[model samples]
Target chain A: MVNTVDPSGPKPRRALSARNIMLYGTLMVVSMYYLLPLYVMVVTSLKGMPEIRLGNVFSPPLEITTAAWTKAWSEACTGINCDGLSRGFWNSVQILIPSVILSIGVASVNGYALSHWKFKGSETFFTILIIGAFIPYQTMLYPIVILLREIGLMGSLWGLVLVHTVFGMPILTLLFRNYFASIPEELFKAARVDGARFWGIYFQIMLPMALPIFVVAIILQVTGIWNDFLFGVIYTKPETYPMTVQLNNIVNSVQGIKEYNVNMAATLLTGLVPLVIYFASGKLFVRGIAAGAVKG
Target chain B: MTSQSTAKRPVQLLRNLSAKIASIPMILTALVVFVGGTAWTVVHSFTSSRLLPKLNFVGFDQYERLWSTRRWLISIENLAIYGICSLILTLLIGFTLAALLDRKIRFEGAFRTIFLYPFALSFVVTGLAWQWILNPDFGVQGVVRGMGWESFAFDPLNNSEIVIFGILIAGIWQGSGLIMCIMLAGLRGIDEDIWKAARVDGIGTVKTYVRIIIPMMRPVFITALVLIASGIIKIYDLVVAQTNGGPGISSEVPAKYVIEYMFRAQNLGQGFAASTMMLVSVIVILVPWAYLEFGGRKRG
Candidate 1:
């Protein structure tokens, strides 16, 4: 793919000086500002109640212990059970894997059809999906619950998976469609001229070039489906709840005194996978954004 | 010639047929699941459903009740304040971060990653983490008091009036990373000549950002506004995690209200009613926005 520079001249680089020093200094401080809460959470989680009592939140704990993590993983009481969030780990996996796969697959098809085939009402479909993206998931919650009940899938993992896929499809489709539109029309024409069927052209030609975007779609779907709470809580049966639901229960359950350490531990544990994926895929995700897939 | 042409005709026909057939499943799934699901929600809201959805018509009584309820009223009012504050803070912070990073700073990738990674985590965790940090007894207050500032009281979770601001802080942290990316994209899209021209005109950096650059970022602003505004309306998990509508229903939002009534409270009628109102509001805002957004593209 070609990197298109602006037809205009480049801006001359500004030299660094005392003013620059102050600007960069301020920016670094702001970056620290952004990172403060996470730092506080980590340090506090490492401390016992005694050290936490001493305040001085920025300081490393005089004594560190994994006790909070241990409690959060296995001993934290959610309701009547102290099973922690381990029970829901498998449930999140069940929802996350299949939902991402199905949603991405459908999005790939939607993108290809909208971009290449340009069928009647295709633009209308794309427009509707775009609009649908802005409708908060809350607006659809009640009806979705009732619909699931009618289909006998409400309170089931299947219901949750379907809901995730429905919501995931619109943005996923938009991402790929916009990216695919940037690919040369000549490539598609050549494939068609070479007697390639529609699916053949997509599979043999377009799919390989789509790997970068596929990585992005995967990251998005995984993070989104894994982090989802409202849908998981509302649609899936309790046994099938994701880690987010478990974390919510452990953290927000109203019956007793809150355990800040255990709550932070569980929250961090639940978020670990996405955070890992995010750091690992930061390069690709950034490149994907620079591809302008989402820019108007 | 006859054989070749006849073969091509069938192949072409098959290609067209399969394309049409393929779209059927995708289109139908979207229609039956999403559109149909949304329609069912609106219709169910009007009916008197409880725990389980029943088809008994209750007219607009649920809607009437929703308006009169203090909880519903408070939820909307709180959401407005939360949404506006969050939108402004995230935009300002996000734009600053993006602009700063664009200045060819040290470890640009690392800094960007540090800033952007927060967005990848679920709000459930982010909310909980913030909850712990902001809790009066155990969090910042504890630390501050231990440092001998005995009067320090950073406990928004316990106070009703100030709790909403506490919630907005967390939302901004989670959302700003995304806005940063969008703004960065817009910044990178700017024509180099604009910057050169500004420099030639002896424009100060601050003046350039305010006058020349910010105005050019209209698309980015619109994108950010649309995305952020929508998310704010459905903002449930963060508030729940941070405050759980604490201090006696002080922080309740529409989404949480709907959820509570749906299952916990078993007032599904009101749940559906609240949802219906939300959906109507969404449509009301979205229809015009969608038209302006899409209409300009194909026509303009």
Candidate 2:
């Protein structure tokens, strides 16, 4: 099997050798496993209710229709609102924008300071922050609820935004800290020697130089906050529920007639934002998650 | 030293005032939230807080009740099952996929994107999609049955005994790609000479991977293991979306248990205890990883 196709050649491997067949065979089957669900979703979302009732989930639609998509977008009932997933879409967008901005804003600055400015006990605080990332969010949920209630921001989008900022701080700060620390210290010193203050060096020198890391941070936060369910459910009201929460309610609610097509459409719509970000950004998305995973 | 200390002590707080000011959020979060909040919860767990968090000092009764409760027991059992299976399977599948791609295969990028696109979607989407695909009437069971095997029985979601595996299927689909990507990075980090050396020694690919590549990739495996383990303990949304602890609480997870008690059950004490358990579990997962990862460097 090792050299059946190319025994006399310099390289013994062949394109269609038994080994290649097994390798590509396993990958092909696994890829089918990955691709099958998405295909079922698209096909289901296109078929009508009557057609889907035929009980063939894997089959393509007899005739494609966008009714389910529109209804999912504008008319589906999710917790008595019947306003479809648009409200959640907007809610997620509102939550996503502010959460991303505030979290990244605080985190980038925090990262820059931790890496460059060695204040007294800074390492102590930084160490605490890193450990903070490991603490289960369940343990801290009520305390944050109390804190938000104290601040009069409980059950509001801003409270959720603040939660995202706090939670995202650890990973984002680590990402930027490592990235900024890699930059030659001479650049920071030169900027300092040129009569630059903290904000000056940060805004003028660091921000522009850290564009790639910023993109990485954005890719990380966008999918994370967008796909978030627990926080959105915990922190926001039904009216202000993010897409994931609304999506769950819309699909899992026990009170309504189950619309499989609409549910598929709703799930697809809920997934589109992050999916677009994932595909469009490609390798950067991998870098973002890897950074989040292999903590420094 | 005393004179220098005295000279700089007065201006110490003022030094890097701007940087300190910039760090206010991190400080407050680290101190007031992470440390303070966790401590507050731990304290509250000792009290019999119901409806609202009041300091009643119940002396472990909440924990006693929690351990005895069937729901919490099932939740923990499910988490353990899910965690262990997920850890091993994720590593195996992730490494296999990584190795296949590392074989200089054609369309690696396309294959990876196909495999990982699910990770970008929310757990709700993954769950619902799998839920539909696992539907008894229209899903795999049905499709296979229609193919002429009338006695086929693959319905796991509605079955109490195998419900957790149903959720496990969805969880793996949504997660293993991350481990694959990480493993691929580790694989690429290996020197080309290692592969060349193995080839010159007339070693087979499987032997090289088993005896050589895997042992050398301990750090990467540990990273993946730690990531998967911690995530398994936090499993909530996927369960909620997929099973919602359905078929009579068979698929409940600890995270879901924590949320239900705190918010819906209005049993704050139980919630605190359960969440504290989650924290302990996370620490249990992290401590060893930390020791393996940084113990030598930190201590020696």
Candidate 3:
């Protein structure tokens, strides 16, 4: 198996090796397992209702149609509103953009402070924040609801954004703090020598150097805020439901016929944002997850 | 020293005023939301709060009712089965796949991307996909039955006894890829010289991994364990999306129960008690581990 006879020559043929065969075969099988669900979703979404009812979900559609996609986007009913997932899509976008910016903004600043400017009791707060990440969100759900209601932000889009920011702070702050800590202390000292203040050095020096981390943070937040069902469902009004919540309502609602095609289509639509981010930012997505998984 | 520090305190506070100001959100969140909110819930759990929370003490009546409720008990059982199985299977499959991928296999990138793409999508999407795939009429069972095996019963979603396993399948499919990625990183971090040393010592690759590499990767495994354990405790969306605790609430999980009681059933006291139990369970797992991981480090 160690083909070291001629170092510069082409490797000897091991195509039929048992180890190679087993490795590739297992990989292919597992790949098929992972690919199967997405394949079913795409095929089911593209097929007509009649084809779906024909009860062979694995087969490619005989007459492929984008009607389900259109219906899912524009006209499928979630409940009383027949406007499909478009409303939820826009609502998600509204939640995603602001929440992403606000959460990342506060987190980056907090990370910069914790990493560079070590005030008294800062590490205590940082430790608490990190541990808070492990506390189940359910324990704080009602209190947050009450807090948001008192502040007149409950059942509002901005309220949902605030919730996302709060939950997102722990992990995002951890990511940025770790990233910032990896920078040479001499550089921060030099910046301080130039009389740069807290926000100034952060915005001018660290921000530019941490572009990759920022991208990773954005990818993390975008997928997180987009795919959030619990917060969106709990915090927002019915009209302002995010895509995942709306998709669930549309699929699981008992008031109408079970249009599997449209349901799958809506599912795909809700998943599309994160799927695109995952594919486009492939290695960075891995890095983001690694960073998020660091505390764990 | 105390007098000198006290004299410098105001000056120190004013030195990095902006940084101190910036950290206010994090401090407030840690103190107010995580600490204060959790304390509030635990305290309120002792009261008879209904749709609206009040201070009327009930002396563990909520907890008593919660324990006696069949739904809550079923939720606990489902979570236990789901959590234990998910932990074991995810680590096993993830480690196996990572080991295979570490063998300089071709198309490693493509295989990893395929396995991990599911993790990118939400549990809602994963749940819906698996729900369709497990649908008795047109899914795996149906396909198998259509191939001249009429008596093949594979509908875990509908069956009361095995519904949690149905959700487990989706859970593993969505999560194991992440564990694999982490494990692969751990494997990559191992020195190639260790493999050469093993080869020179006439050790089998399987023995090398089990006896040597796995022990070396204990921290990585711990990280993955904590990740999976947290995810297991919060297994709500997948259940809701897949079966919605259906077929007579056979698949209810603690997180789902907490949410359903808190919001839908308008039972605030019951919800708080259930959520407090969840907090207790997490602390039970977290405290000793945190002590070992961080506490020893400080002392040493």
Clashes of each: 2, 0, 0
* Better structure of 1 and 3 per DockQ: 3
* Cα misplacement distance, residue B148 of candidate 1 (Å): 3.3
- For candidate 2, the per-residue lDDT at A291 reads 91
- For each candidate, C-alpha RMSD in Å? 5.0, 2.5, 2.6
True contacts kept of each: 0.50, 0.76, 0.72
Which candidate should be chosen as best, given DockQ against the real structure?
Answer: 2
Candidate 2, residues B1-300, lDDT tens digits: the string is: 011244555334454798899999999999999999999999999999989999989899999999999999999999889988998999999999999999888899999999899989889899999999999989999999999999999998999999999999999999999999999999999998897778778787789999999999999998888888878888899999998998899999999999999999999999999999899888888898888888868631
The RMSD (Cα, Å) of candidate 1 is 5.0
Q: What is the C-alpha lDDT profile of model 1 across A130-195, one tens digit per residue?
A: 556655566577767667888899888888888887887777888888888899989998988888
Evaluate model 3: give its lDDT: 0.90
CAPRI grade of model 2: medium
Candidate 3: misplaced stretches above 4 Å?
Answer: A1-13, A294-296, B1-13
Per-residue lDDT of candidate 2, residues A105-183 (tens digit):
9999999998888677777888888899889899999999999999999999999999999999999988888888888
Sorting all predicted structures by DockQ, with the top scorer first, yields 2, 3, 1
Give interface RMSD, per candidate: 6.0, 2.9, 2.6
Query: Which regions of candidate 1 deviate over 4 angstroms?
Result: A1-16, A53-57, A255-257, A287-296, B1-9, B51-58, B296-300
**Model 1 residue B250 distance off true place after TM-score fit, in angstroms:** 0.5
